[model samples]
Target: MEGLVDINRLASGEAGRALLERVFQDDSERFLRRLRDRVDRVGIDLPAIEVRYQGLSVQVDAFVGSRALPTLWNSATNFLQFD
Candidate 1:
């Protein structure tokens, strides 16, 4: 999708929030890599991205979803819990 998959397009309030949560929810490189791999199958040029954590940032060559982006969360919370 060229733009965001709006929260309203989702089936329900909870599902809509969940979908948004997943879109912004931070995960490991493994997770992002998997998503990128899936996007590669479609063969379109995915959006380039920069995800900043703490004071550090990494430029992702491509990403599968809209760049609606999200507010940074505390890293002290376990990544597993977010997953």
Candidate 2:
């Protein structure tokens, strides 16, 4: 959350996952703010990134989508849902 947080550029899904965990842990409030801002900008009707992140997980299971936390970890493919 300091410079740029492009999940796409990460070495792997595990790396991405670890980075996310770090960001979320460092400043959950700020992270949530950014997520909320992103969702707002994207014009998602759901209005909650936590929900989307939670529901989209196959490998990276989400514990509490509203809380913005990752659960299970499999791989980047499953993590990002590239298929």
Candidate 3:
């Protein structure tokens, strides 16, 4: 897999209640290790990405089905929640 699996593709609308699921059903340890490695590469320097906010806005969500992007609950009005 080139990227992480989108769990919302399962479309249950809730998170963290399942003890196990289809995602990571095979080789979860390797999957998680890869995940950690990917995460480690992000945001090492704050100033490097400060301009990212200059042209940003909340998404209008025109897609009707599963999105490839794992959409977070973004707060259009709350800057603190951007994390």
Could you tell me every candidate's TM-score relative to the true structure? 0.23, 0.26, 0.21
Highest-scoring model, lDDT: 2
| Residue 47 accuracy (lDDT) in model 2 | 37
lDDT of 2 by residue, 33-76 (tens): 89989989998887335533555645754534433533355344
How far residue 61's Cα lies from its native spot in candidate 1, in Å, is 33
Worst 10 residues of 3 by lDDT: 73-82
Off by over 4 Å in 2: 1-26, 47-83
Model 1, range 1-83, lDDT digits (tens) per residue?
Answer: 78966566683688787866776665565688888898899887977899867977677543234432342443323343447
lDDT of 3 at 73: 32
Taking the tens digit of each residue's C-alpha lDDT, what string does model 3 give over 1-83?
87875655644544532423544565687888887777678735333444345667786634334433345533332334444
List candidate 3 segments past 4 Å from native.
1-26, 44-83
At residue 20, candidate 2 shows an lDDT of 76
Clashes of 3: 0
Model 3 steric clash pairs: none
- List the candidate numbers ranked by TM-score, top first: 2, 1, 3
